[model samples]
Target: GAGVSQTPSNKVTEKGKYVELRCDPISGHTALYWYRQSLGQGPEFLIYFQGTGAADDSGLPNDRFFAVRPEGSVSTLKIQRTERGDSAVYLCASSRGGFGHEQFFGPGTRLTVL
Candidate 1:
């Protein structure tokens, strides 16, 4: 009964470098979400996956950012040609697989692009 987990609690990379952030949701949770949080802003929703496919990804900043949940459990956020502005805390959360369900959040991955 482990909660959500994110790898590489912290990451530092040069600008324009590609990086991947991983997330493992709680067991049996079918709903997963990705969010980004800046210094003063609240966590901004990035994408949501229901099962093995992305159900909503309207918040993705651009094509440079992408995410996948191939088996409906673990997910990876891929950032390509990263920019300094991409620095932020990337959070992952999961729920019982529906709207209004309480979501469990991970500690998040702090990404710093120099």
Candidate 2:
């Protein structure tokens, strides 16, 4: 792959609903990240995966949010009990190195909780 790619570019759901956002990273990239961007704000780191384990998940607001990279290439962000405040663009990125390295971002998945 050329870069990160996100699926279901847009999503609409009722409050309390659950959603899953997917990310496909470039081949051979071992560092992956997930971020959430609210209106008028920059992307906020949500989680980071180094290989198949989550290296940092402190950015996740609460237990309602989680992500996984099982094969170290593709990842999925899972949100539970979605709230209206959760409406935002979910972005995925990948780099060849760990933190501090340049990241290639994917076109985000816009999620709306109505």
Candidate 3:
């Protein structure tokens, strides 16, 4: 894709279910990130991948959330045992360099847990 694109624009799942959100970053972007946004708040970083390896994932809330960028261009965020509190918008962004670079964000995938 030319710009960042995320699949399954909206997802509604029951509590304890598993969900996978996909993000396709712009080609040749060296940095990819996954963030979650709750109501009335800014996006919170979940993971940051420099190329194919995760450089920093300190912001992830718990073991239930994981993100991977195996081939570097595309990434997926997997959430296990989803809860009602986990309902939020999962956002994906890409940048050109390691850190402090301008990022292009995709339209987030809205996850709703019931």
Candidate 4:
């Protein structure tokens, strides 16, 4: 199967609006991750899901940010009450869910909150 993929590629929204970013991981990958990268900054981990359950979510900045991998392959990142500071590149990655396995990253979704 192909590598991870994200939808829309880019998004523009006004403050206080809501948005949903989608990610499609490679087939058979059990570990999926979400990250956010600000301008000139490294990507920050937001959440990790193993199969259909979230294995780690402590990196989520607040309750307004959430993610779900309902079917264990496709995931969605949801944002509520968007803010200008929320503008960033939302990246998705996937791995084999094994220790020492390398994670493959998607092209990312550039979100601009105006």
Models, CA RMSD each = 0.6, 1.0, 1.1, 0.7
Worst 10 residues of 1 by lDDT: 95-104
In the range 10-114, model 4's lDDT, one tens digit per residue, is 999999999999999989999999999999999999999999999999999999999998889999999999999999999999999777688999999999999
Residue-wise C-alpha lDDT for candidate 1, range 7-113, written one tens digit per residue: 98999999989999999999999999999999999999999999999999999999999999999999999999999999999999999976899999999999999
The runs of at least 3 residues in candidate 1 whose Cα sits more than 4 Å from the true structure, single-residue gaps closed, are none
Clashes of 3: 0
What is the per-residue lDDT of model 2 for residues 1-114, given as tens digits with 9 covering 90 to 100?
487899989999999999999999888889999999999999999999999999999999999998999989999999999999999999999999655888999999999999
In model 3, which range of ten residues has the least summed lDDT? Answer: 93-102
Taking all chains together, the TM-score of candidate 2 against the true structure is: 0.96
Decide which is better by TM-score, 3 or 4: 4
Candidate 3 global TM-score: 0.96
Q: What are the models' TM-scores?
A: 0.98, 0.96, 0.96, 0.98
Best by TM-score: 1
Give a tens-digit lDDT track for model 3, residues 2-113.
8999999999999999999999998889999999899999999999999999999999999998888889889999999999999999999999985588999999999999
Q: State model 4's lDDT.
A: 0.95
Name the lDDT value of residue 48 in candidate 3: 93
How well does model 2 score by local distance difference test?
0.94
Total colliding residue pairs, candidate 1: 0
